[model samples]
Target: MSSPSREAILASASRLFGDRGYRSVTVRDIASDAGVSAALVMKLFGSKEKLFAAAQPDERLLGELNVPREEIGAALAFRVLMRREREMQEPWAMLPFTVQDSPDPEATRAEAREKYLGHIAALIGDTTPNRRHAAVVVSLMIGFGEAVRTLGLFDDWDFDEVVAHYGALVQAQIDACPVA
Candidate 1:
């Protein structure tokens, strides 16, 4: 089992990395934020690069890809909304930090983008027309997720209302593409 200090270091690393991108955060910063010694972090994660690998967004949430087509829209909307609610809930919060020209390694960014796209494709299934709609769904979810978390544009709306509206939007995208 991991020690509390280790968990704390990781949590701090995730938060810092998510906020500042990979190359910008330091082991010392994570150590200080976790109230631990820098040596401990180095000992635990070896190098800053390794620590970042550990801090990369957990993709297990994609397991929901098994949801039926009828439920995928709501499931995805709910998942994105929940991710916005807490940094630990979804790795989506760190997406902006891992984009092109960012400090994140190219492989890491490509892997993340591919994985998310795969999840969308799985949700939308194998239909040729649905493939394009899957891209739209991915874009909408990312835009809406960012808006709710970073833009404050939806601060006035109730949470359930937001989910409903967003879910409807997602469903509309899905509905627009008929399955062959």
Candidate 2:
């Protein structure tokens, strides 16, 4: 099993990179947050760049699409919200900040657009490829995540209540989409 220090370094890297993006954070920053020395971080991960890559967020936000088409939005909402609690990072929720601060802004933006927004568009059945509705849904997703995780908007609220209400809102946006 990996040592607790290794896991701490990984979690610190994930949070710092997700919150501040790749360019803004340094090895010392991650090591400091993890309560370790920079040397140990380098020993474990090799380099800051490598550590960032290792800490990249999973693409599981839109994963596990076994639900009915009509219920996809709620499924997505539930997954993202739950992940915000269980996982250290929320790539979709943190995309804007990451993109804005990225050293290679164009590449970062393009990759995210293709992977996330494109997949979301497809999930919403925009086969005609139009994505206006899906974009709005993404906005709501980011907003909901920020409100809950960063701003603590739902900290005192019931988890089910927050997810259910937010899920329904996401579903409403999906339902508003023009059928392909």
Winning model by lDDT: 2
**Candidate 1 residue 176 C-alpha distance from true site, Å:** 2.4
The weakest ten consecutive residues by lDDT in model 1 span: 85-94
Residue-level error in angstroms, candidate 1, position 165: 0.8
Q: Rate the local accuracy (lDDT) of all candidates.
A: 0.75, 0.79
**Prediction 2 TM-score vs. true:** 0.83
Give the per-residue lDDT of model 1 (tens digit) for 69-174: 7767787778777776664534555676666425455776677667777677666763664368877877887787667666767779887887788888888888
Q: List the residue pairs that clash in candidate 1.
A: none
Q: Which stretches of candidate 2 lie over 4 Å from their true place?
A: 1-6, 43-47, 128-130
Can you give the lDDT of residue 25 in candidate 2? 92
Error of 1 at 42 (Å): 0.8
Per-residue C-alpha lDDT of model 2 across residues 1-180, encoded as one tens digit per residue = 489999999899889887777878999999999999999999999887678767767777456577877887677767766886786577666777666766667887898777777877878876544588888888888787777667878878877787788889988988888788
Candidate 1 local lDDT, residue 149: 64
Residue clash pairs of candidate 2: none
Index of the highest-TM-score prediction:
1
Q: What is the TM-score of candidate 1? A: 0.86
